[model samples]
Target: MDCLNCFEITARLHMYIDRELNSEEIAIVQEHLEDCPSCECRFHFDMRIKRLVHERCTIQHAPQHLREAVMRLAHAPAGTYAELDPELVKEIKADLKGGG
Candidate 1:
């Protein structure tokens, strides 16, 4: 099988991490990830984010501000959220603690 490039692997990252891809696709993605460190790092980061959300976000309806903050984080590039604003990260952490 031809190795998948970064674009293909990243494009399917969410599905791959969620186990939504079929066996062959999973094999292809796994092969690409094993060969490419950059994609692997991104995959791990996304997995952490997904796990964090699953662990913390149990409420049926999040507040508007919380939702907005999450959207901001979601749109941000990997590892850029804290660099963009450490204060915002702190605030979010505090809010999550209080809300929990």
Candidate 2:
């Protein structure tokens, strides 16, 4: 395979990370990474991000109280206001603001 430029390698990086590329394409990317330090660093960074997202997105059971609150909201009649824990509200607001 011809030598891949940084742009080409980076563009196909997600596919490489996901193992979606064919053997030839994967070989090309590996060859490029072996020769290019910058792309290797980027590959490591991107892999870390991928791992972080996967870990965070994995399904886990919600807290019992939170589950109960959601059930209450689900069962509430229209126009009824369900009271939320003040700390939970603040935490939710912080998360929305990217501070959580």
Candidate 3:
């Protein structure tokens, strides 16, 4: 399953690395990885990066106020949560392109 050079596939690489991919997409990524060195390296790199980050970072509870704010927003209209944290999203997009 050779994937096109598209954003959807890029978005999915992170999901796949996180084990958040659904079954069908998982199968596609699994097949693609077997044949695609670039994608395979991307997967390995992302996995290693995340693993190292987790290993080094101490787990800390989210502040009570932050949790409460999220909880309050959870019940809001669907579009309310649509906005992404630009900085984090940029980091994700950059990492997907093999640029840390």
Q: Which one wins on TM-score?
A: 2
Which candidate do you rate higher for lDDT, 1 or 3? Answer: 1
Find the 10 residues in a row with the least total lDDT in model 1. Answer: 80-89
The candidate, 1 or 2, that scores higher on lDDT is: 2
- For 1-100, candidate 2 gives per-residue lDDT tens digits of 6888999999999999999999999999999999999999999999999999999999977656667778889999999998898887776566557733
Residue-level lDDT of model 1, residues 1-41, one tens digit each, is 57778998999999998899999999999988998999999
Q: What's each prediction's TM-score?
A: 0.56, 0.59, 0.51
Between 2 and 3, whose TM-score is larger? 2
lDDT (Cα, tens digit) per residue for candidate 3, span 18-75:
8897788888878777877887888788889998998889686654554555666686
Write down the TM-score for model 3: 0.51
Please give the lDDT score at residue 76 for candidate 3.
74
- lDDT for 72 in candidate 3 is 64
Q: Per-residue lDDT for 51 in model 3? A: 89
